[model samples]
Target chain A: MPQKHLVEIRDNPLFASIGAESFAALTRGAYVQNFPPHTELITEGEAADFLHIVSTGCVELFSIWQGRETSMSFQTENSTFILAATIKDLPYLMSARTITKSRVIMIPSQDIRGVFERDSMFAKSIVSELATCYRNAIKTAKNIKLRTSLERLANYILKLHLAQGGRIELELAVEKRRIASFLGMTPENLSRSFAGLKSHGVEMDGQVIKVVDAAKLEEFAHPNALIDG
Target chain B: MPQKHLVEIRDNPLFASIGAESFAALTRGAYVQNFPPHTELITEGEAADFLHIVSTGCVELFSIWQGRETSMSFQTENSTFILAATIKDLPYLMSARTITKSRVIMIPSQDIRGVFERDSMFAKSIVSELATCYRNAIKTAKNIKLRTSLERLANYILKLHLAQGGRIELELAVEKRRIASFLGMTPENLSRSFAGLKSHGVEMDGQVIKVVDAAKLEEFAHPNALIDG
Candidate 1:
């Protein structure tokens, strides 16, 4: 691995607190690779052999059932995928594919479990990281169950709006189709939802979204920290 | 806490492997209480002061947004609720209510974190428990996003049937309204979905559900371990 990639991987909170020895051991057999856009990195139902962290660009975590697929989440830079599966040594519950040409770090699950057992700091960090993941999943479920598709899309845009420092004009990171799937709607429904948001002062043109009135959008979305975060 | 409650709490996989001293420290400040049906145990967005364990009966973990409420999960005996929030000292994401007359054990969050720091085994157990929670949430997302109301109800009934040792006649412990909410459908939709399942050989009478044709139900439900587990 390059010095820069090592630094970026180390910056991840999951690896930040580990002892130097454990960190070295974790990275010893680890390898970094660049994936082309649309590359399938891992598939659901397969053994979680490697713990994957996106170094740059994007990776979409998705699932398929009865010939239908839906986007679970998208992992960008520094985001880890399937830590719970790697920790539990279970089958991957969601598949991963690179949405853009990306760099990713793959560490052996054995090394992860080995360090988790021998290093208390690493173990504690795993607890915190896993807790965060669990909470996020619960939040996702709540967002889906408690809100309509329009509300989901509205809050999703508000989330991106907030994430981008409340810019009046923001570009969506993921494609509309993937965003639609993540928000549990069809592409057609997403288009319709975006049209519906026009009344709330959101205007869209392809990938670019312009928040015409932030106050109106916020009032309409009612983005709650507990659900949105 | 009573000796029985202490033993049951210890039996939880999260606490099963901790040292006696750590276990004693955890239970020292803990207390067990019984709640009547429909009792609200914890509200969403409140500080997670206690790590709750359902010692007896059922507790429904649900969330409310605006005026709509949805069931997240129904935790039963030996199941822990909101461990991630308790460990992280964050607000509860979902409010829990007793669906049946219930006995619950409450362990203080401070003690949980204290013992977590001192006990490596306990920390590792927390990793496993949290991982399980995370994966369950993903499965739930897939179930909601990928399956329709009828499919969800079919699989849910199939799950209950399997849990009852493949019994031909299985009783739904929860009411139809709650099951409908949990499956992300309206009560009218739930009734319609149940009616839709009649072609697959299922019969419903109040809370009693009879799997008239197990083979047909399984073929229709197609319960996959990766998604259903």
Candidate 2:
């Protein structure tokens, strides 16, 4: 059915230790799907029927309340999304939509449960992945609750620089508005915050950012106050 | 060994469909210990060595930043803490301390790894629990970032009340200062906020609170606007 998606589950460490036969069974039940940019893949409060693996492009995970939306996370290549809801068969707490044209592999949740029932290694991997996710989310929450909006933006910029090998030159992966939402700030405030960071040796043009003084930026960001654990 | 503390493992629903025998073997190597209030059961950034099960008393989980402390969660009777860090054998992101005289069963991380290696059902349970913890943490994060300080305190009180069957005769398990920190506000702000709530039909004496007008408080809380999912 639809060229069977050539499941690359083996690349995922969660299934790396599982027996090849079980992996084959998982692949047999999986299929590939492609969506255009801005396509809503998973909606909040909807039943989770499949575990999604992003093979290309970017996806944003976000939640909405009272007609207002906030970005929770951004998922990119080689990452899986919605595992928690899929595993529990619970309604999603956040919606996921493609930010760019994307390729994804879809694995039925029932098959995932079947594999977990039969494969200890696979199950262990799932547990480890979930734990790592939980730890990261806790860190994000701490950052949001303990730090001010400007602090969040500063730290987020530093993180992106570090993630991009200690430099930010090209256009950013997402818009300032999306990034502002991700940092829990209003877009106007984010623009003003960027202006505030200019005195701290930060510069941006369109989507491109440059940290002119890394040390000064760190001082302004309060590196010691930023969560590393 | 400290009167043996009776370290029996049960197949709690949180652990999925794992059988009692599997749980027994998983905990066969576990050890039990008792500690006085304020004991630091686990510290942030330390290597996770054991999965702790709280059998008696409450434990407060918190993180510190720039010398300011914020409460992450509180674990009470019949609950497990830190499964996420324990499963991955990663450093803990937060520190945990006993709030009252307590007993805890510590299962060595090595034994847990062995159990995962040998038991599929137990592994599934671990994944399920981790997933639940992750989702709960996400919900908490959404609650904090998307709501105002006053709304947060209102929902916090309402949630506690609901957890106690929509009545507030019971004492708050935490101090007002700790509650303020947990709600990401100062003690002074919390005091002022509580006073403001009196006009909205909320009455409190020390830790005991009574919502004289549930509908009015809910209206003030704007639960639908505050919750993400």
DockQ of each: 0.91, 0.65
Superposed Cα deviation of residue A130, candidate 1 (Å): 0.9
Clashing pairs in 2: none
Q: Model 2 chain A, poorest ten-residue lDDT window?
A: A1-10
True contacts kept of each: 0.91, 0.75
Clashing pairs in 1: none
lDDT of 1 by residue, B122-219 (tens): 99999999999998999998999899889999999999888989898988888989989999999999999888999997998878899999899999
lDDT of 1 at A12: 97
Chain B TM-score (model 2 vs. true structure): 0.90
- lDDT (Cα, tens digit) per residue for candidate 2, span B178-198: 788878889999999999899
lDDT per residue as tens, model 1, A1-229: 7788888888999999888999999999999999999999999999999999999999999999989999999999999989999998999999999999999999999999999989999999899999999899899999988889999988988888889999988988878999999999999999999999999989998899999898999999999989998
Q: What is model 2's interface RMSD?
A: 1.9
lDDT of 2 by residue, A1-229 (tens): 3433444557777777889788877878888889999999988888888888988889999998666688999999878988888888888888899998999888888888788778777777788889878988998988887788888888887777777787646468887888899889999999999999998878989988888887888887875422733
Two-chain DockQ for model 1: 0.91
